[model samples]
Target: MFDINGGELIVLFVVAALVIGPQRLPAYAEQLAVLVRRGREWISQARTRLDEETGDLGVDWEALDPRKYDPRRIVRDALLDEPSTARRAAASAVVGIPPAASAPLVGPAPYDDEAT
Candidate 1:
């Protein structure tokens, strides 16, 4: 999730190398590798356990996926929708709810240059 670039990564590596001496760096690296391996194993186990627990819930996995909760896509779909029927539009006006429409025109525009 970090937005680290190559130059920044090199700087980080140089700083880490300077802080942690070369003599002990190998040992620390080995420990870090082990920690990462264990963390991955723990995550995999947790995921499997979760799947086993919820495997029979009849869940629509794709529908429930977090990635599908996109506000832009929802708004695009809403905006692209055609206008409602004439009866429904009338009902929406009566209910004070704006109708979902594509460039709906109310009536002829009032114009008078001398009114101002």
Candidate 2:
């Protein structure tokens, strides 16, 4: 997320080495690693507690992902029932209209530049 490259990492290491000195750098690094591990553990515990409190109910944990959690997926899934989606597709097929042509445009068409 920070977009740190090899050169940036080298620079960071050099600066840390200078500031903390070679003898103490390893100790500091160890402490930092421990803190990061603890933080991750705390976050996982909190998520577990929240999930327990909510009782999951009918929610599918298999489909749930912490890294890619999206609230909209729940709403979209609720709206687009499998049978209704199939019925809509079948109705559209009977009308001989391509599904892509029925979708709404979010903005002006790309070819508008050429037209102008």
Number of clashes recorded per candidate: 0, 0
Query: What is the TM-score of candidate 2?
Result: 0.46
lDDT of 2 at 100: 61
Q: Which candidate is the best by TM-score?
A: 1
Candidate 2 residue runs with Cα over 4 Å from true position: 60-116
How much lDDT does each candidate structure score? Answer: 0.84, 0.79
lDDT of 2 at 24: 92
| Model 1 segments more than 4 A misplaced | 1-3, 63-116
User: Residue 23 of model 1: what lDDT?
Assistant: 99
Q: For model 1, what is the error of residue 52's alpha carbon versus the real structure, in angstroms, after optimal superposition?
A: 1.4
Write down the TM-score of every candidate: 0.50, 0.46
Q: What value of lDDT does candidate 2 attain over all alpha carbons?
A: 0.79
